[model samples]
Target: MKNNILFKQQLFLVLTAIFFTSCLSNVDEEVIIEEPVSEITFNVHVKPIIDNNCTQCHSTAGGTSPNLETYAGVSANAARIKAEVESKRMPIGGTLTDEEIQAISIWVDAGSLNN
Candidate 1:
């Protein structure tokens, strides 16, 4: 009877380990799909992101430098904007979602078009 109990306990431990190993082994890594750069334009995608996350600090009426209130300002500073947001360094008090950051990156990659 003692041997039977010991064998059952060992079996339970082995089963638990196998269960966890199988579950964890099936976990998938996150994949980020890049949108066509042409589909991601300045007005349609990038502006709203800037408007929501950046304009509070970088607006025309605000005290912040490098105002993002216009296309020209944003397009001109596209590289800096992409770098800062990608590093999660800008916006100071706010956050940009992965999707928003991706949009900004693609926009910059597409030559920071005014469209």
Candidate 2:
């Protein structure tokens, strides 16, 4: 009877260890989640506006301030860019429509993607 009890105890311990180990392994496993980032096309929406309004003064050759030729350049100056757009300080000689200003603001807020 003592031998049977000892065998049962040993089996219980082994099963408990296996159950605990499996639980621990599952706890350590990693779960991945994929999120899609919205893409903003630069040429279609952003470029024409800049070329028509800003390039005259913001270009490298013009030397009005800084050149806004690329995405990095624009992103680096996002705060100033947004402020200028919001306040209608850009396209210096003329005013931008509310929709145009809002579009520029949205683009900057959306991570200023080059796409």
Q: Provide the overall lDDT of each model, using Cα atoms, as 2-decimal numbers.
A: 0.91, 0.72
lDDT of 1 by residue, 3-67 (tens): 99999999999999999999999999999899988899888999999988888889767769799
- lDDT of model 2 at residue 85? 83
Give a tens-digit lDDT track for model 2, residues 1-115. Answer: 9999999999999999999999988876555332223533456666667767787788787787768766666668767877998877777897777656666666777777777
Where model 1 places Cα greater than 4 Å from the true spot, the runs are 1-30
- Estimate the lDDT of model 2: 0.72
Pairs of residues clashing in candidate 1: none
> What TM-score, computed on C-alpha atoms, does each candidate reach?
0.72, 0.60
| Least accurate 10 contiguous residues by lDDT in model 2 | 32-41
Backbone clashes in model 2, listed as residue pairs: none
